[model samples]
Target: MIRHLVLFKLNDGVRRDDPRVVEGVAAFRALGDLIPELRFWECEWNISDRPVAYDFAINSAVEDTDALKRYLEHPAHTAGVALWREFATWVIADYPF
Candidate 1:
């Protein structure tokens, strides 16, 4: 199994209700359909402590490294990137288990 984790540092003045935030969450949830190897997924909007930087984080599990790679490069992911690129900074990691 492989785990894929992503964190997003939102842009200035951005809020959880912003369209970009809404779309980001939806995109991550929708990824399971396009990437069949997604074994499990979770996305959270940061609502506590009010961090100075990020607004949300996403954690996902896949069947293997290859699955992680495919999810990373999927067109749906690319589309999501294009949609939120201007308002977000993201980080990703893949770990085998």
Candidate 2:
């Protein structure tokens, strides 16, 4: 399986309660149910206020690289990324287990 992880940092002046952020969060949260290639999904807002902490995170799993590609290319996932791009920057990593 491939474990895909992401960390998101909201742009300066962007608040967690902002409407756009709320929608983006919901959109990403729904992907697990919308995409068949996803074997697992976990998306959440960060509670920590530390300077090094990201504002949000995604932890997901898929069968393999092919499935991971399908998940990334899905319309819902693309839409979520587009929405997030407006207010945040992120980093990601994928590894096999």
Candidate 3:
């Protein structure tokens, strides 16, 4: 399986409660149901205030690289990314285990 992890940092001045951020969170939360390639999905707001902490995170899994690609290309996923582009930047890693 491929574990797909992402850390997201909200743009400066963008609060988690902001309407856009709230909607973005919901968008990601709904992705698992929308995409069959997503074998697992979990997203959450960060609670830590550590300097290295990001504002949110996404932890997901897929059968393999191909399924991962499908998940990444899904329209719902792309739309979520587009919405996030307006208020955040993210970093990701995918590894097999």
| Winner by lDDT | 2
Ranking by lDDT: 2, 3, 1
Clashing pairs in 3: none
Per-residue lDDT over 17-71 for candidate 1, one digit per residue giving the tens place of the 0 to 100 score:
8887788778877776777777987777767665464667778898876777787
Relative to the true structure, how large is the alpha-carbon lDDT of every model? 0.78, 0.97, 0.95
Q: Give the TM-scores of the predictions, in the order they appear.
A: 0.82, 0.98, 0.98
> Cα RMSD (Å) between model 1 and the true structure?
1.9
Taking all chains together, the TM-score of candidate 2 against the true structure is: 0.98
Query: Model 3: per-residue lDDT, tens digit, 1-97?
Result: 9999999999999999999999999999999899999888999998999999999999999999999998989999999999999999999999997
- Model 2, residue 56: distance off in Å is 0.3
Worst 10 residues of 3 by lDDT: 32-41
Residue-wise C-alpha lDDT for candidate 2, range 32-75, written one tens digit per residue: 89999999999998899998999999999999999999999999
Give me candidate 3's TM-score against the actual structure: 0.98
**What stretches of model 1 exceed 4 Å from their correct place?**
50-53
